[model samples]
Target: MASPITPSTGLGSGLAIGDIVTALVNSDKLAKQTQITTQTKLVTTKLSGIGTLKSALSAFQTLIKPPVGTTSKLQFAGYSATSSDTTKLTVTSDNTAVPGTYSVKINNIATSSSVGTAAFSGGSTSAIPSGALTISQNGNSKSYTIPTGATLASVVKQINADTSTTNISANIITDDKGSRLVLGSTITGAGSEITTTSDITGFTIGKTDKLDATSATSAGYIGSVPASASVTINGLAVTSTSNTLAKTLGGVSLTLLPGSDNSTTTVTVATNTDGLKSSLQSFIDSYNAVVGAVSTVTKATVSDTADATTGSTVTPAALTGDSMPRSILSAIRNELVSTGAGGDLSVLSQLGITTGQSDGKLTLDSTKFQAAMDKGLAGNVQQLFSGTGDGSNGLLARMNAAITPYTQTGGIFDTRTTSLNKQQSDLQDQQAALDLRVTTLTATLTAKYNAMDLIVGQLKASATSITSFFDSLNASKS
Candidate 1:
């Protein structure tokens, strides 16, 4: 491809036309071509570094935000709940819970009503008079027809599977006494009692088989009569139609287990110190991750032994001398150590979260953190990460505010990345144009060298013909 004539082409020109043309063209292209290659790789590396930094910033923001939209668990003053007598009641606490112990006497747990029809002496297939039966619960009712030859089990099955009956469930209990249809309500509130009636004379789901709990065993007793739950929080005698109580304590929920009346229990709600520690630990870990990521991009290093063993030279991060990484570290440090006026717990240091070794990474001192917890997170953990007004004055909020811009669409990272990508595009365009020019110039030079070889071959043939003419003349003279 270099030239039409070559030494291997049997031409007597004695010139390496192909090699000469190629060398000239290559010499003209080497400088600009190398610049394009090196620039492309450098730009790509910078873009990747920016992408990693943005990811770190986004993760730190997620850790700072509320885990759920409903509650600010990250900003909660943690609570621990305990029931002194768990046999009668169980308890749990929520955010904004207060610390207190109160006497709780579960006068009665709410119960759902149930009624059973008169027992049939014959087998479960015993037929009943044709009639209309209506079952009602929780303001919903369903009607069913009792056919002329319907058995006891068929009637029970029909009532149990009716779609219109929302809160009532029916079953046929066939004990030694015989089979009786039992109807119970799904809810325990006062108005949730299940009721039933039938047009057939002397045949209805009535309370004929109600268990007297006071005199019956646990196995024989079933809940009847929809009654409101009764409990005394701090001897205040609160009443509820549901067994689960949430307003009994300032920050706890109490679930009533079935038990006899007149049983007294004690309930306590207090701060969960370990839980508080775990929540704070999240911030420490996330902060450390961001710090490590940024450090790798700004001030990476290697040990002397590793460098010597691997023959690897020291090459700092691309962003090492850039103001962006420096400013990023400085801004986060400012927020981590910043405090509010007259605030109980303002800075991260108050919660025993601190950084060391000239790096922006965070560390939690357990001993100091325990001491802070002893002082109730130096008063309130809520006001620590969330301020007294609007929650914008705390460490978490400030850090979020500082870091949010960097990851947004038009922030510093976006601008810098856009610029780098443009540079990469420009270099690629330059390389393409330069390569086309080199190709064209090489072709032109090869064409010119090929013509020169043809001319030299023609001149050599002319000289050979002249020498033969002289030799023939001398032979004629001899």
Candidate 2:
């Protein structure tokens, strides 16, 4: 069999064969294709709407609910620690910090030891003749041998190179006088004392009480002895190796500012009313958003209707009449208003968060809320939303539990979406099959019409030849 030819246009008998074939195939599949398209469009639209609803619900539940959200850190009250004199000390605290006021007298700030070698004419490049020196701290010692003719910089490097046991840092510091090797303790406090074992006439190398933390570095040996930070808290002595004291008082940390020696500053921690208020407002906003979303999905849509008697249009909500949405919304609304669940501040209304009569959405009265919390309900606010018990026991917890069956993995929405996806895929397959069949039919029609045109042209030529032959014979007889 010959390969079928597809014409450039409707070439068979000039009868627009391609158009006719296309019309036939399209007529055959039109109804079925229309049904599938309509169904897919409706399903997709419904899915989109549900997605919006679910997104809003998930966002609110995850952001505001302590058990289900990152923002659960809101459970811990915020405290602002301020010093009467920030020059003495200004501080920040984590959620663990307990709120209180304490008197702090900084007798002295912590110090680091700064020690150096005696001046040399050549400064940092000056040779540190070959010698073996030992550096000790905290009763542990380590030694390093200087290479012959080592520069002052090279000696500094050798001393600082191995601090695993020496526990001291060395550097070359130079001024107008000359350069010298400076060694400072890696840590602060009396235990961080640095001692050297070496005899060099040009340098004094050893731990000495006379070498304070701020000694001059002009001479061959300038060792600034480290000191522990000392402060008096409530008239009691407190000491720390670091300036920032950790938990010296119950759930409190303090630091001595520079130049606070013999000076006093008071640190006060208190409830951050502004921060708490902002958190509460966030909760209200999330609640409102969820409520609005539910209403959008479930609320009955209204349209105008013609009145039979008065010939006038009357507007009414031709409700979807879907009991599922109504039931879900009604359950949530009832829960919001229901009382006696738990806690003295058991109701959302007590927090000035209440549903509006008209829109069925929630609104927050900031003034009323602030007043309620200020009047001593602040302590119970957490219990009202996030109480201890089963997840459904508290208001916020109830909301979280209610949506879990739909939003969580292997859930209601997941099942519906999966089924819809399969349906869509099946529709696509059917559409592709129809398109292929039409293409095949079109090719068959084109070839058949082309052959028919050739046969018709041949017959017309044969008739013309017969007429010519007959006329020739007639002319001959005449």
Candidate 3:
């Protein structure tokens, strides 16, 4: 097929059969090309959607991610310069602390726990252990089998072994022969009462039978109470319940210990997180999806070929060219891999997302990736994707922002669509003009040919009759 010609080449200067055929073939080619170009533009639009969605996700993730391992560490502003030497500094967190220069030595730090109470002994023989006290809370029940040889420590080991509950400890007060089994509340505001479905046998309930509770009042947060109680801490009259008395004095903050009053304090802090680890994983996921999508567009698969005349299928090799995938890859790489005056920040590799020399595919050193993200990942991620030009910052944001201009009237996409529409309109007008021209040509050719056919047919008829008459005349004359 010949390539389509523009309006300037509509009909050749000289009219001929070859020229007419050429114009038709060229028109078909132009139409196909326009369709392909439009489809490419549409594909770009779809990819923009993918890219923007990813950017939005990245933004949200960047905002909430805690700074490295800082989330796990307890932060207190003020302590007496000589407090470490004078007082015992204890670690409140259960997990082992990371090795670092301590603000104070954690001397004589005791692990947080609850002391369990003694179990009730003896159950009625036919009652199926009914007489023994059963501790029930939140629909979960556990029977205390106080054996003849049962000790408080043995019960504590059993409760600790049960994975269903947390922090259950049992200890004996040997001076009073009173065994106390303490159930530690895994969370704050846990219910106080421990109910029994079975009878309490050989066990006496005392004023201390109730579980010891850690409350907000004991923690010294007096915001709820209006009347100020005078308490002298290090010879300082701390009146307010919520104010940082220690912090006000020489930028020092006090770490308030948990109280045993059973009221949960409003100050609930998050535990330390394994920073950078999770961030690296997310980046990997997004990066892989994009890479895979590009690979799919660039690679080709085998297909059966069709014969031109009979349309029979056969194996045939054909060359196909596609630039969309490569263009997308380029856009992403240019955004991520370029360095700027913002320092040496460029590419995922610098931030620990390395690519191999052989394949040029992204690989992650999780430790490095996490550390970077934890300490300074937000700046790095933004820096990597930021674009060149005055005020066109952040590669993803820049590209997504650029998409709006392409969609506007007379923009690249708009212009192409407009141009294609004009081409189709002009093609239709040309087709209409061709209809008239062909009609005129057909009439003129048909009339001239019909006249010749009619003359030849009549002559043949007359000759046939004349031969017959000649035969008759010959016979008569003879």
- Give candidate 2 misplaced runs (Cα > 4 Å): 1-12, 42-58, 65-105, 109-229, 232-271, 294-343, 357-360, 382-426, 455-478
| Number of the top-ranking candidate, with lDDT as the measure | 1
lDDT of each: 0.74, 0.68, 0.41
Task: For residues 48-95, write the lDDT of model 1, one tens digit per residue.
Answer: 888878888888887786455654435356567888878788887765
Is candidate 1 or 3 superior in TM-score?
1
TM-score of each: 0.67, 0.61, 0.35
Model 3: how far residue 79 lies from native, Å: 26
> What is the TM-score of candidate 2?
0.61
Screening candidate 1 with a backbone cut-off below 3 angstroms (N, C-alpha, C), the clashing residue pairs are none
Arranged by lDDT, best first? 1, 2, 3
| Model 1 regions more than 4 Å off | 1-14, 66-76, 82-95, 98-188, 192-237, 241-244, 254-268, 300-314
lDDT for 335 in candidate 2 is 68
Ranking by TM-score: 1, 2, 3
Q: Count the backbone clashes (under 3 Å) in each candidate.
A: 0, 2, 21
